[model samples]
Target chain A: MTEQPILEVKHLQHIYMKGTPLEHHALAGVSLKINKGECIAVIGHTGSGKSTLIQHVNGLMRPQAGDVVVDGMDLADPKIDIRLLRRKVGLVFQNPEDQIFEKIIGDDIAYGPFKMGLPIKEVRDRVKWAMELVGLSFEEMKDRATYALSGGQKRKVALAGVLALRPDILVLDEPTAGLDPRSRNELLERLKTLNKKENMTIIFVSHNMEEVAYMADRIYVLADGRNLVDGTPEEVFVEAEKLREHYIGTPDTVEILAQLKAKGFAVRQNAYQLEEAANEIIALL
Target chain B: MALPLIQVKNLSFEYAVNQTKIPVLHDISFEVKPGEYVVIIGHNGSGKSTLSKHLNGILTPVSGDVVVNGWNTKEWSSMREIRQKVGMVFQHPDNQIVATIVEDDVAFGLENLEIPPSEMKERIDFALASVGMNEFRNRPPHYLSGGQKQRVAIAGVLAMKPDCLVLDEATSMLDTHGRNEILKVVRKLNDEGMAIISVTHHMSEAAQASRVIVIEKGRIIMDGTPREIFQQEEELKRLHLDIPVASQMARKVQSHHHDFNGTLIHNDEIVKEVVRLSQREVPVI
Candidate 1:
């Protein structure tokens, strides 16, 4: 038997400011399925409904026409508990700084678990674990003023706050948007560890093709509030013309390989990773 | 040679946190020549943003000097003149956009300078056209995509007629399409004799620069042309930075093939090199 999906969206449709002159169709018949322990990436240009699709995952927004189911709980069911669904799926927005509120880092991270009314000890433990996972030292950084933290550290604190809830699925919108190369890499590594070691399901919306290629097990390309294509990075990136038509960018490695293939070098066009592309070219030589 | 457009001498900066002075920038010095495209890259907390802020006197240095267009930023009387000469675009497009309408936003800077209404109208028209936002001049900025909003932001800055444009991670929040849009506009401006100082984490963006500056731990560690800096791949990796994917692929091929000698920073260069070395009939794709 095929494994059941942890989260499923069927013909999801959403419209912003419906019934008004400024109404916009943000999502139109978008559908996707995510298995447990899978790392998925959603890529699209701005205004392509990528954000609207993820917002539906955690019951943040109810579908205007279709259905969303998370862990067998149908969001369309009026009896479904949204708080429970949110606890099972942590969502981090693009600018994590906007989510930070507490003056102290520890206080900010602990806010989530504390709000859940967990035992004091459990809250502390969760906060510590979350901080450690994000590479922030609980001992050294917990008491630091949130305002004083760098852009990267602030993002970590925001992430830790979400992780303190111990969500089985973590959904991020541009998790490394403003981070430097080092911080971006470190965050991707931590997310990978979460998926591999803890079997946590991961879903992220990003504009960075490199990050998507490196971290995603499956890639979904979105456009015009609908699913344009879905496949592995290699498969999706192979259709370079289609992606470029939708204003989607391929990874640099893939671009290099594609250019060489066009020039008739007999290089593999599917190699999206740097080392793999290099090796492909070297073999031809 | 043309005179330096901006000069930073012995630049040092610090922040006061709860009465404790925390240094964020060390003694740093650099000069930007007119019409140069300079990219400043660094890890988080490296004071790159702080340094950019000093360029326009957003943050006065604690123990150094920033002179732009022969006006010292330290002098209160030169603040207006210095700001008029150096325009800054920040990370968040939403944060920087002040007016509701695109054309009005572009006019904000001009009105502040008290330009004659006739000249202001002409400047606004030219600025919007320059960034390719002319069609949306009457549209509300909130409804635009991230890239479109950023173009509007650039248009707003361009209306001021600044000699130098300093972008503090301006494209970090944008998607690939949006980033390309901003880069294209900036490149054209540079070609037309405007100086650019872009602080970015995207190594691909750095590859297009005439010069690259690497900062680490609040200090300027490396300053040279893109080729000069990216050739030392190991050093960049050691500092938690990375070279462009094309450069990395070139190095990987060099390691195994040993004949790929030149430093290839761009994608086409790598493709051309691979085809040249393939020793096979090139097939047109």
Candidate 2:
């Protein structure tokens, strides 16, 4: 808490279709502080303001009210260099089609660095490095057709395209969605390595509690455009009863442990991961 | 025995672009019995979505045939009959809702079939109530959560009075809570004797169905009861699919203590196993 957080949002508020009959408050009084090299997950129902909040992190959508500061750059200030800020903080949308446009994989990845006016060698280096980082072979994938790749490969390409910019902070919206379990695990592992090796700040929005429990260093639960809870996975998941009030769901591990606790068993209710809960229950036996 | 609700015979599909035929599904075949809940799982690009499109006559097979409720999809005239018999719910709920109000959206499909005004009203109310969205009948589609929106989409399809429901990754775009909400509604409808065919990426969701079908490389690779299919964990992993978390945890726990002997799929099953072992004072280091 003492260090200047890498990303901070103060009382963020947003209203969609403002001043109209269909007007809706997408975000309301939401605040967050995320540190460098930490992987944070924002969990909420579909309309719980998760997307709206993350949209503000990279200044994709300006907040109607409130403030967002990324690495000392205030998003509320119109004078700030919005383009430069985007380079420092990359945002990957939920749909792969929305991100991948170029026919060739290499061209799509080089788009960001090319747009930055980086030298030819630097852009080529970044594209190669990103492809390798996401486990895609540069030589093979660079010239391959983007649409011909499988779903998992397309997602990897999308991720590599964002990583090509070498952003210090990366924000992804449902990065593992629509992927098989193996691909989901692979993507999570790649992100963990980036966070550990590059000291990258990761802020991802997800609805999968199991992934959040496994990946997030800190978790935030949003409800009705408000910050319902924010804590470590263990702290937030153990509050099963409270979470239900916000329509928040927990992973199967936590749900099982909570059920045992409610049934008067001498079980550890705070275990969030399956292995941790499994080990705890084994000890009880 | 009653005729299978749907039957696919050597179904094959390919995308024809500029005289190049790119195969998406390969000789896929299956049958869904009345009131049965079947879940199809596969890695992305495994052609599960393509298969779903064939069930409702959205896409015709290139070299095979699909019969839905005794209607051949190949016949252009039977397209309407096939579509009406097999109500399809897609991944994005936002795309399916055609009306501003929930009730109006539910009535849209019925109106297309030229149902009488009195019948349309009754169908709309019944469909909304079936999905537990009757209370939000007056609300705008934009105002509902992802899960609620999906339920409303289901209601829209339900009003068509389909005998079988085919969900093509319908819950993929939702959060855990939203996904569960959709699954619960689907299961309830199945219990009410509506044949349900769900295509999903979530391993846990597949574990709950009456049957699990695994598609790989555009073909049906495996199909059996959940226990039968999940027992082949190594094979599933080879296909880029993951076993349910509880199933994996059970294996991990069994590695330490051989007392837990069962194919655990649900969280409750693992909890019960641990509880049974604890009563017997199984040695724990």
Best by lDDT: 1
All models: lDDT?
0.91, 0.88
Interface RMSD values, listed in order for every candidate: 1.1, 1.8
TM-score of each: 0.97, 0.94
Tens digit of per-residue lDDT, candidate 1, span A1-285: 899899999999998999999899999899999999999999987888998899888988887799898999999887898899999999999888889999999999999899999999999999999999898988999998899888888999999999899899999999998887777898899999999999999999988999999999999999999999999998999988899999999998888888888876677787998778878988887
Error of 1 at B116 (Å): 1.6
Measured by DockQ, the strongest candidate is: 1
**What is residue A62's positional error in candidate 2, in angstroms?**
4.0
Q: What is the TM-score (0 to 1) of candidate 2?
A: 0.94
lDDT of each residue in A45-144, candidate 2, tens digit only: 7678888898898888886798899999999888889988999999999986567999999999999999999999999999999999888989987998
Listed in order, the DockQ scores are: 0.80, 0.63
Worst 10 residues of 1 chain A by lDDT: A261-270
What is candidate 1's DockQ? 0.80
